[model samples]
Structures are given as structure tokens and as C-alpha cells.
Target: MVDMDLLLALASHARYRPDQLAVAFEDERLTYRQLERRVSQIVAAFRRLDLAPGDRIGIATYRGVDPVALYLGSQAAGLQPVMLSWTLGPALPEMAEALGVEHLFVGAEAAGLHNLATSGAQVWDVGGHTADIGGFLAQSEAEDERWIVRRDPDQVSSVEFSAGSTGRPKAILRTVRSDVWNAWQRILAYRACEGDRWLCITPMNLSVLSGMVRAVLVLGGSLVLLERFDAARTVAAIRDGVTILPLQTPHWSQILEQPDLGDIAEPRLRTAVAIGQRIPVGLARRITAAFPRADFVVSYGTSESGMITALSATDPAFGTPSCVGRPLPTLEVEVVDEGGRPVPPGVRGDICVRGPSVVAGYDPAVGPIVSSMYDDWFNTGDVGQWDQRGYLYVIDRRSDVFESEGQLVFPGEIQEEVSRLPNVREVAVAGVQLEEECQATVFVVSDRDNPDIASIASIEAAVARVSQVSFRIRSVDRLPRTLGGKLDRVALKRGQW
Candidate 1:
């Protein structure tokens, strides 16, 4: 039987490959042995603070080995780690309160009010730990005789907050078992093996962190963490032997469009996992052409579900350049209608997911949950349909669907076709009430050039080719979006400029 505690894996790896690199931060490197010793000390030190099992602890820090160490050590000590984004700003206090954290750690200059640190919380200055990591890890300490948690595969090991673009972000708790399973699945799908180095581009607070990091460690690989998104630096890290990288759509687009991106091309990269959103077809083709050594995977998942489905390099449909692909082994996906009944293949409906990784629930106080399923399945807010070959196709959110000319129009569908035009940089579609009744309106973003009647007519033709005949397209210079990167259609409908 597999051991329930994830810490044992780290301990074992440390003993086996003490000198092999376990992690790296910029120029600094820490071997598996060094990581284990440091984590042991950190766990023992926290135990001295009298923190009990199931206690929630918050860590406000940037991406680095120290933050990752705290995350691993907290779980080893039977504490739940809540990672707050560095950009959380004034909301940090409110978030800590919402997560019910009693212990907190603030890194560098990001620490907020001290009043929230309960009597149980022993805030540590990570800045002090950074200067002498070796000294900190080398301290001798007797093993605490405290009870170690034999984790249930279903029990949550960490909590990640959602971006909550349409509303306030909510804390999403996931199980350690699911984390391991998902990581393993990704490793198999991407063909990532030992010695592979991944440049982690997404924030550590994201739910994907646990799976991605665990996958790398399980394969005896290395992770290079970045503080923030920098196109040149990211490419350079890849050039310097980082084999796998998780890239976002916007950032990848920026890199390929930049005149200088090709200057630091890396040949060691085997694959690039593009998550967060669909990559524009044009950009995907360009990335593959530019970097022939690496394969590009279009992945789909959320904080609630780790990696539900992914498109591999060799799949026949991988070149479709739009679909997210078939579901993973552990995941079960269904396209359901408004009545919660399963819709037939080739028909659009809400995408419902059920699996080990799906979260149990969200906080009701934070916001209304309009998309959760009534049954065991977790309803993804997205509207999608399964093709004849069982490939899932996402249309748009149900709320984002609006009636134009007495028919339904999905913004995602229009946006996809509109994005095909060369001049269009970004596009968002919303329904506006032009008459006494509501009608569809499309927002378009183009560079410098004003869209003439001919250009507008061409867009109308494109919409007519795919959309319900009643809907019409409206040309606008800009569209609003929430901080989480989702289109702010609600504000647009309310006539907000």
C-alpha cells in the first residue's frame, strides 16, 4: 500500500539522492538532502509553536524555494497551508479571516496587520531564513513525539483561492491523493521524465502548483520559479536547459509577437503546457514553428479540478488547435442541459465533472454559486458539447449567452471566429438592448485602424456562417474584464463605460 503522508516521499528521496538537485531559485540550488533537512527543522520549529492538526496557516510570499519549503513542511506537520497571492494587497487581512487561519507567515515587505496573527500563530521572518538557508537546514533537533497524520486520499492538504472574476474569489481545498494522481497523469501525458527542468510560470498560489511541483519531484526533475512574468527572462531560463514550461496564452502571444523573442531560443525544451485559456490558433502554429524541439499541449482545468482533460502531442485531434481534448483517466465529464439531464453528443450544454480532484464546496458568504451541480457531478460554468468522436468543445458560459434577433449567441463562439481576422487583437461579445427587447452586441479590439463598412460586413458574414441567423455584430474599441482575466459582460450590460 502507498504511504498516506507525502512527506515520507520527500524524506525517502532525500536519503536516496541527497546530492541531486531538488529545487532552484535564480542562482541558488538546493539538493534533495538539503531540502529534507530544512523541512525537518521547519516542521520541528512549527511544532514547538504548539500548532495542532487541522489548523489553517497562511503564507503571504513570492515564488521561491522558501515558500515551497513552508508549504511542504506545513503539510508534513499536519497543518493546512493557505497560500495568498503577492498581489492580494489590502484584501490579505480579509482573506486570512475568511480562510479561518490561526497561524500566518509574511515574507519580505509583504506582511500586513499583525492583529490577525492569533496567539497560536508564530510569524517567522523568511527574510532571515533566506540569508543562511544551509545554516537553517543544518540545525539539529529531536524528532517531535507528536502524532503524525495518516492522510486520507480525500482529505485536503492545501487550499487555493479562485480568481472570482464575476465575483469575489473563494478558497478551493483539494485532496493530496488527487494531487498525486493528477501529477502522475500529467507526467505520463507530457512524457516528462527524470532530469527534466521546468520553468514554473504560473503563480504558486494556483491549484496547479501542487500537481506540477509533485510531478517534477516524482520524476526527479527540477523546477525554476519566476517572481513574475518576463518574456525575455522566461525564454532565457528555457535556453539554459529548462526542459518543460507552463505558459499562459497572453504571455506566449506577447513573446512570439516581440521582435527579440527568437534571440534566446532554447533547444532543450521538449514540451510547453499552455494552460489558463485557449491559445489563439495562429499563435499556437507560430510557437510550434518557432520551437520545433518542443511539443505544445493545450490543457484545460480549474482550481476546483486539477487536470481534468488535456491534448497530447500525438493525438489525431491535437492539430485542431481549438478543442481542449478528451478527459483524463480519473475524470468523468458530461454535457448536461438546464434540467441537469445529460445532453446527447454534438449538442451544447453545461459541462459537469466528477472525479477525485473536484472540490466538495465553496463558501456561501463570498458569493452565489450559480453553476454547482445538484448531484455528485461538479458543474463547470462553461457551456460545451461533445463531438461525435467524444472531443469536448467549449462554447461559452451560460450567463454569457445572450439573444440576438430572437436567437441565442455565445460570446466565445463569436470571439473565436472574430479572432481569426488579422487586425483583431482581442474581442468580447455581449448582448445590449437596442430595442425594447434585448439584442446581441459584439465588442472588437483592433490596432490603430478604424473598421470600415467592408471590414464590418466581413465580420457579419463570419458570424452568419456560424451563429444563429437572427444575431448581429456590433463593433466596439474595448471590452471590460475582471482581474481574474474573464470578460466582464455584466458591467458591459449595465452600460458601464
Candidate 2:
């Protein structure tokens, strides 16, 4: 394999497979030829604004063709593109300015649009690829030296902002080589091929989405996107010629609960990947049965490390929430103690990993998650243990674990046991403070369309077997999730329970 950037790879694919579909979002489609042209147009627009190479541009648009177009356009013209959180509402403009993003592309309907008028950066309304940006693209001529530019391997290729489920977010800057390596990593992990079509259910701004898009496009494969994750829409997409499907833990049970899911036989699904959070065996088994032709896998990693380990449901040892399978072939993973010494098998300790595509470090100024960004092995801040068979199990995030009766309590342990309860659709557990006491709260949603939820006494009885902590079980219609469709633990801890 040769070292290649996403932009260079795009040009190669466009040159050979001009008629192949490159991206699909809703009813909008872009073949390789059309995607290439739109990227060129975006490059021209950037040049017309006199933006120089290495200039950082911001993309504050909703999910659609434009964000990918802008990303390719900037990188092809030798610039760095950062995906800003459009959900920030009024706080977006100030956040954009703090990052030194001079030229911004603001979607007309983006939630941050209300505050765009007062921003220091130049803003453009290109919602659904309409407005002045469309006019600029319509006037650009195709095929010029502007189609490609010299890019340093070490240059910043993309900047990904973490979801900050812990507290505050951090900016993870990846270089051209690093980004390319990560794309290749996902491609290898998912066994992507030229004919594969990935259905991206996650938000476009997510770090995982960036790699998945590149992996598909780099292989001349097609990408189908959803504005957001919906169980009905996702099930419909899978039945309609989607070869690969990836979703978070919370999204799986919902898809299985879809009344229409069992009516359709979606044999076209070749791979089903579960990420974001752990998948209980029961949920994983249901998912495995749902996609008879697909391989169900659990992908475990962090923004700092690109896909450290993936456990297929087929693995004989895949029955626990923490069993994340073995480390990927290209990385080094170790369970270290408080003194930084490697622990023996079955010993729980800090998880440290370093390898290709692993981020070099975070921007030191983004002090929110600096504890994990030190030199050498990146401390994942996750408590983990390695079984005698070389299988790794992630115990819990060090920060998420709480003390109860002088014993460390893992929220995942409680959630996993409660997830096994009958008629319990979705459950999220977190340690919260209520009247000077730390309480383990289990926010649950019932599967049946009835006001009655799972028995609280039964849930309490189930969790009592797992830990001694007192849990306050609350039945809610649904759990609050982030734009990425992940359980927003940060919000749940902030009295949102």
C-alpha cells in the first residue's frame, strides 16, 4: 500500500470510476464525476475569497452534500477544515472565533444561524447547497491545477472536537498522514471493498464519521447518510440495499424494537458494527439475529486512539460488557498499574495504547481533557483488565466510577444487569448527587407502549446482585442523547435525570 491523502485518493477514484456513485444523502446523490466537480467549485470559491494554503476554515452546516464538498475542496486546495458544533446555538460564533477560523460556511438553517450576524469571521448561507455558494460553484470551470495542490504529510488535515461526555470538549488535530492512516485502519477493520456502501448514521462532524467517509470514498465505494439516527429510518435504509450498518449501543435495541423490522428480511447487510458504548449480550444477540447475513461487532476506542479493539459477537469470549476483544493488529495495548508498570493477567489497571493513526497529542491549550494527553503512551483513563486468553475487557472510565460503601462501583455493570431485565427497552446509569448523597440513577425506557415500566423492585434486585450501591431507578420515555446519538452522560449527571 502506498501513502496517499484523501484528496489524492479522490482524484484517482474520479479518474478511473467517473460514473460510480460516490455519496448519497436522502434523495440527493453525487457520482464521482459530479462530486469531483463540486469539490473543484468549492476550491475556486475558497481561492476567490483569497484564502491561502493552511488556512483553517469552519463548517457549521447541517448534514448534506455541502459539508463533504467543503471538506474535500479545502483539503484539495491545501487547507485545514474544522467541523464546528452547530448545536451550540448562540455560543457558536464566539467558539468559532476563539479557534481562529476566519472564513466560515454557515448553513442557512443551522441552529447557530441566529448568532452568525455578529461573528468576526465571514459567513455564507449555503443550507442545502443553496444561496451564493451555489452560484459560485455554478460559475467555476472544471479541470485546472486548482483541482489539486501540494500537501505536506505533517500538515493538519482535519481537526475533530470531542463530544465531551465527561465535562468539556477537546480539539484533536490530526495530520495528513495520520488522517490517511486512520482511514486505512477503518477500511481494514470493516473489510471495506470497492462495492461496499456504508450507511452513516452518525453526525458528519463526529471523528468516526470522518474516517468512515474517507474509507468508503478512498475505495471508490458509496456512502449513504441520514440527517440523524431514527430506528424506523435506519431499519428502512438497511432493507433498501445498504451493505454496511454501524450504530451505537442505545440505537440497536430501538432498531430491534421497530415493529416493521421483523417483517422485512434485510439480507443485504454485510456488516453491523456497534460503537460508542458497550452492547449487552442480549442486545448483541438480538442484533446478530436481526441481520442474519451481517457480522455484528463491538468497536471500542477513544478520539485519542483510532479504534483500539473490536470484538465480534461471534467470538466465544464476547459475553461481558468489558470484553472488547484483543487489540487491533497495528497497535500496542497494555494494562498498567498506578506506578506505570504492566499488570499481570486478570489484573485491572489503567489502559494505555499507542500506535499508527493514534493521535500524536491534543492541542495543549484545550485544557478540558489534558490529563490523558501526556507524552509516550496515551492514558485512556479507562480501567481495564486482560484475561488469561489475551482478551481485553474495559472495566469503566476512571472518572465514571464512584465509591459506594468503600467499594468502587461501575455504572456499566449496573446498566448491563438492568439491560438484561425483560421489557426494559433502553437504560442509562450514572452517579448523581441528590441531597448530599451520591445516588446511582438508572434512567430506563419501557419497550411496550404502556405507562407501566419495568418493576423498580426487580431492577433494584438485579443491580443489588452486581453492586452494593443504592440505585434510584426512574422510568422515562427516552434518554437524552447528543447530536451523535450517544447517551449524553454529562447532561444526565447535571440533574437532567
Candidate 3:
């Protein structure tokens, strides 16, 4: 079993398609050849730190092309790069210590902006000036690939944070084999090809950005990065030319709300993938009408696994609520009981998966990496079921479902029903502890200035149609979103919204 070397693959791109566009950020653009050279320079720069192969380096940067190059540079240098965001202020030190990071490359957005106590790890401000990353690139004038470290295929490739909604993020450690397999799978799963331009708004700290970067690089495609997401800017980028557009459902909602969205259509836009959460039928229809040529897919995946299931409009259960389509090729997905036995179709149970891309464990905060797998299978902690026709339906997170009034209340069910209500922009249902008691509450963001009494009644009726439990409805100005632009459900549960 031979593992593919991502560095070698990237170098091949530079050799074959040197002039093709690789990355675009603001006014700066780099061809494949230039990007490869930059990676070599970063590798040369990394050497000045007296760092050895297998040492951990933290990348805390803003949305830009440098993070992409730094990531590849880390791979070429045999350093395990742990991604961090500037938004993580006080918690940065704790995470760096836990991951055993030896050095941190801080981005310009983080320089002097936030105090990131990095748990005794040496920090380098690589955000500004020519050869600013600790003056490592300037210290050495080497442009050769001889500095590239030959690493073991089984060695940890990179560490990424888990995208769970209601828990402290985990540092998922993916091996070289897993990452290589994931990149290849994404190229196949997304049907990516040469010259395709990927619109990347998600920061490098998220797995989606890195995965897209690898696939795009492998296919000789381009990455068009946006420093910040604006509805008009996104639409303009699409009009110019964009083939792959991946974002959370909330982002799509904001785009759909664009006043001039319906006035123009982009023919070059081919794919619009919905991430983070399931795309509701209403939003799905709107996206189809907006970008009729594009294939709006509802993708369901986790940090441990690259991609599991995705919902496409062509599937029979495309519009069915919670139906996330079938698993992609080469991956094994199963719905199992508490005993780890496979459950029958139509029976809800824990979702588990086993495949080459499934990460074996997470980076522990203190000791060594701890395995999260059980008997070669990884439990997704999501409860779902399969229909008779082989379509998978995700119900909700295990912890998000609770008992109330002698009935199990799935927050997704309540939120899904209420999301259909008129004038309700967004909705989140949670059974959170308040003061001394736990109560079921429906949080909403509406267009009206005040919470309409009639709307509240409609929300209760909507939940009543789904379950017997009662819930209190409160409409707020806006729902909270994470740094990765995902709905912060845990923050909502904590009354931080």
C-alpha cells in the first residue's frame, strides 16, 4: 500500500502548469510556479528557526494566500502545522500547550491586535514586511527543493479543530495517509477539474479551506480568496468567473437576501455546496432559482472524516427534510444501535463510519494523541436513519435531543418546522439551563422590530405540529455565528446570543 506524497503532487503541478493561476488574494495573484517557489522559500525560512522535522508549528492567520503557502511549506518541511485563528484570544495559549506546538506563525491581522499567550511557544509575526516571518526567508537565499524533508506516510500531517456545535473544539490529528486520501476524494466527490476557480471565504483554520486548497492545487485550479464576505463582492466574483462556491447555509441565506440577487445570474457558476448544516427545502428552492446552472449540494461531513454523505437535487429524497443523500464512493457509512450493531432501515440510531480518510484520533491537551475510534469505526455522535430507498436522514446531535413532557424533543425538528414560518429570518431551538432550571426555548431572528405576538403563537403551533412538548419563543436581533461563519448553537445555549 503506497501512500501518495502531496508535496510531490504539488511540485508536479508547478512543473507541468507553471503559468496557470494557483491563488488570488486582493490585488496579488500567484501562478503555480510562483506558489511552489514561495513554499520553498517558506521552507528555507523555517530552517532558520533551527526546527527539525516533525516539530509542531501553529498558523494563526487571517483569510489570505499566505496561509495556503505556509501550509504546503510546513508539509515540505515535515512540520505538523496546527491551525489557529486570531479570534481565539485567551484560549490560544491553552490550545497551543495542549497540541505541543513549538512555534507559531502569527498573521498580520493578529499582530499587536490580540494578546496570544502561546504557552511558552516561540511566536513569529509573519504578517508584514518582505520576508517578515521571523526574517527566515530573507536570512536564506535558497530556492532549491533540497530543503524538503522526506516524512513518513504514517506521521501526523496536520492538526485541525473539530466543527462541533456544542462543545469545546477538539484538535483532530490527521496522518499523511488520511489527508492524501481526503484530498483525492474531494477532487472526485466535487468533480473538480483544471482551471476551475474556487471561491474561498472560509479561513485556513477550518478544514474546508485546507481541503479545498489541496483539491484545487491538485487539479491545477485557482483559489479566489475574499478577506471578508460581502454579498455584493461574492456576486461580483461569481460574475467574473467562479466554478466552485462552498459556504454554510447561513451565508447562502444572506446572499439570497441581496436586493439585486435576482437581477443577475452567473452562468459560469457551476457548483454551490451547502455546508455546516442541512439546507432546508425553502432555501434549496431559492438557490436553484438564483443559480439554475449550479448544482446546490447539501454536504454532511465531520472533522474525523473528510466527506460522508451529500444531498443533490437529482436524488429522490433531495427535498426530504434531514435526507443527506447517499455516502460517496469508497466510504463506508452505517447506522448502528447502542451496542454497535447495524440498525435496520427507518430505525434511528447513531451514525458511524470507517474509511481511509477517517482520522484515527485527536491531539490530546496534555499527554499523547488519544484515539477516538472504536474497533475500526468512528461514531459520528449524530443520530440519523436510512430510508427504504437507501437515503440517509440525519435527525440531530445526540446531546441536542432531550426528553421534555415525557416526549423526546429534537431541536432540529422544532427549528425545522418553525423555519417555515413567515417573517422568521432564522431560528434555533435549544433546551438550555437558565438560573436553576433547564427550559426549552425557541430563539429567532425576525425582520420586525418587535416580537410579534401572533408570530410567537404561530411558532408554538408549528412546534406543536412536530411534538407534544412546549417551548418558549423569543425573537432576537440576530443569531450568533462562529469565526468559521457557522451558527453558534452552544453560544445560544449559554445565552451569549
Candidate 4:
């Protein structure tokens, strides 16, 4: 049986390895013992506030130690922690009200935002010389006591909002059991060890970030936290013995553009896990060349499901185009047609997953929005296919695919193919609706500031090889991406290009 109390496990590590580093930010480092003490104080503070079981606590803080401590501490005190992204800005107040948040912790930088006052909850500022609430908490009397709240396994522990790339982001629920299982799955997939040093560059609001942090802590590993992603700084950290790097696809792209990347020799870097979206083969190859010593992994998952599939460096599908690897050992994955029947290998279908890692359902206020999809199996709303060897290749989101001349065309596939062009720097492909049909349009970011006609012709030729439908090619300075670093296809289709 899995231990549902993650804080208790963290406390055990603190007792055994008091001096070991638990988390590091810039020049400041906190040992396991220190981290445990801080968490205990936070838990006591929550009790002092009279927060009860299931009371929602929202955290909208910059990437730092206090946010991590508050997240784990909230759950330990029997409150459901909600990770609210600072990017939500004006929309945050409504989201918090909908989630029934009673208390909110905002980073010092974001504390002065006007919408925060309208959240209808008591707010505390954390970090950066600000008179933060965390600093006011008195240390608990018994630091070694097991202060973890005991609750039913299926009770919600954390609430995360979906990436609002398509529309309004929905609140997804995660139980203690699912959270624990997700951590274990990540640990197994990454082969994380007690001695590993995890570099956390993504925002804490992301589900992947929480899972990565939990996996490292559960395995007695240390986390190196960065307030924000800086390519040059990240490269330097890698050279300084950071072993595991978990980042989004856009982060990899930005890191590749850094001129100082080749100057760093990172022998300690073992794994670089790519989350958020599918990565093109050309870009993946560049990442592998840059970090020759590190394993480049592509992970597929969502807010509702922890990690459904992962492409490991050692796996045969690592270099395969669009392959997200096989289903995780903890889950069952399937690709089915519109009728919900399983599709044969090599045929595209909606990807669905069901297992311990999948959450029970959304909160009642979300009102069955995702329950139908989450019934017996959760339809990911993504199109994918499995090879004969069981390797899964995610084509694109189901809605992102459009029929062109009676042939279903995936913009992701076209984008991937166009990205292989030697002169193309970045690319985004979207289908534009025409009379009675949709046509593919390719937007290219050329290596040269002004791509000549010849360069455009070369990209068109590359895209033509995999696609038979007619396509329009345009050169743009750069492609627009959502806050989470995913291509904003909805914006593209709306002619925001």
C-alpha cells in the first residue's frame, strides 16, 4: 500500500538526514531539518487560523522555497492547497472564489495586484524583504511530532487549474492517493535516486512541477529552485552539478538559443524531462547535441492525469518522430475511434487513459464538465497512434486536426516536418477554415531576419513531402505562445498571426 501522507515521509527524511540539503535558491540553502521545522511552523500557523479539513488554500507565489513549503504544509494541516499561477492576473479572483478559497498566499511581487483584493479571502504576502505572514509564524513546540492530517485516501488534496490556452481554465482535483502514485511513477520513469539533485525551473503552479518536487523529496533527493527560467543561469547550474532538469518545451527552445550553452560542460546532468507539449524531432536532436551527457525525455500528461506516458532516452522510441513512448507501468492507455472502439496500430484515434494516477473527478462547482470524459477512462482529447512495438505517437489535440480535401491533416505533423528545414528557426501550423473545407497555413520563423523567397520555397518543399493538401506559407519574426509555453492555436486561427 502507498503511504498517503507525503509530509510524514518528508519528516522521516529530516530526522535521518538533518544536515542534508532539502532545497536551494540562489545562494541560500535549507537543510532537511530546517525545511521540516519551517513546514511544522506553517502547519501550526494554519491551525492557529482555525482552518479546517477541506478548507481551500490558494498559493500564487514565485518559484521559491516558501511556496514549496506552504504547499506541503497546507496538505499536512488538512487543507486542500490550490496552485494559482501569477499569470492569471484579473481572472484569479473569480477562480479563487469558484474554488472556495479561504486563504491566499501571494508572492511579494504579485501582492499589490488590484484583483487580489477582490478574491474575497485573507491574503498574505510571501518572500523578498516584505513583511510576510510566514515570517510571523511562531515555531511549533514539537518539531518531530507527526503533524500530518489523516484523511480518507480519496479525499482531495490539491487543486490545479488547467492551462487556459483554449478557453477558461478549469479546476482539476487530485487526491492524496493519485498524488502519491504520480510521484512514484515519475521516480520510476526518471530513475531518481537519493543523491540526485533536481533543478526546478518551471512554475510551481504546473502539475508537473509539484509531481517532480514530490518525487525528489520522497526519494530523499535535493531540489535546486530558480525563481524564473534564465537560460544562461540554468546552463551554469547544470555545470555546477545539477543532475535532473525538468522543463517545458519552450524552455528547451530558449536554452538552445543561448550563445553560452556550449561553454558549459555538465557531467552531473543525467536527465532532462520535457513536459507541457510535444517536441519536434529536430529540436529534440539539438537539445541532445547540446547536453550530450543528459537523457532527453518527453512526457505526456495533463492536470487531471499525472503522467500517462514518457519517452526515456534509453527507450527505443527516444528518437522516433512524435513518439511519447509506451504507457506508464501504472496506467492503461488506448486509442479509440469516434465510436469509442479501439483503433488498430498505425491508425489515429482519441487517446484515453485509466489507472491509479488519474484523478477521481473535478470538484462539484466545476459541475460535471469533465466527468463524462473521466467516467471509466479519461479521454485526453488528443489524437495519437501506437506502433506495432507499442510506442505511442501523439499527433495533436483532437480539435487541432482538420479535414483538408477529405484527408485529416494534423498541423502538429506539418509543423514538425517544416521544423526540419535547415533555415527554419521556429514554426507553427494551423488549419484555416475556407468554403466547405479547411486549408493548412504554415507560419515560419526564419534564421535570417528577412527570409528571402528561396528560403520560403525550401520550407514549402519540406512540408510538401509529408502532406498532399495545398498549404500557404508565411514568415513571421516569432510565434506566439501561451503562458505555459504551448502554441496558442486558437489565437492563430483567429488571425492573430
Best-matching candidate per TM-score: 2
Give the TM-score comparing model 3 with the true structure, all chains together: 0.93
What lDDT does each candidate get?
0.69, 0.76, 0.77, 0.78
> On residues 1-497, what C-alpha lDDT tens digit does candidate 2 reach at each position?
22345666677778888888888888788988888877877788777878888788888775677777787787777777777767666766776676678777877656436667566887776766433463546666654654477776667777775636654766788777667777776776665677798988757455666787688887878888787888898888887878878788888877887887878864588888888677787888888877777887788887777788888877888776668888888788999999899999988999999776777666544444456754658888889999999999888888888875567788888878888888888887777777776777788888766556778899999899988877778888788877777777777876574
Q: Give candidate 3's whole-model lDDT.
A: 0.77
In model 4, the runs with Cα more than 4 Å from the true position are 1-5, 127-131, 134-146, 364-374, 404-407, 432-439, 448-454
Instruction: For residues 377-442, write the lDDT of model 1, one tens digit per residue.
Output: 887788888888989877777767777666777777777787787677666677766557776666
Over 1-497, each residue of candidate 3 has an lDDT whose tens digit, in order, gives 33335666678888998898888887778888888888888888778878788899888775567778888888888888888766666677667777788887777766664556647787777774323456546656545767677766678888985534554667888888778778877766566777899998865365777787778876778999887677788988888798988877888888888777776654588788887687778788879878988887888887788878877777677789888888888689999998989999989999998988887587667345345589878888899999998888889988688776677888887778887877777888877778866678888887443355336678888989988877878868788877677777788778665
Steric overlap count per candidate: 0, 0, 0, 0
Worst 10 residues of 3 by lDDT: 447-456
The estimated TM-scores of all candidates read: 0.85, 0.93, 0.93, 0.92
Runs off by more than 4 Å, candidate 1: 1-5, 112-129, 132-148, 264-266, 363-373, 404-406, 431-454, 468-497
Whole-model alpha-carbon lDDT for candidate 2: 0.76
Between the candidate structures 2 and 3, which one is better when assessed by lDDT? 3
> Can you tell me which runs of candidate 2 are displaced by over 4 Å?
1-3, 109-112, 130-138, 143-147, 202-204, 364-369, 449-451
Q: Predictions ranked by lDDT, top down?
A: 4, 3, 2, 1
Q: Return whichever of 2 and 4 wins on TM-score.
A: 2
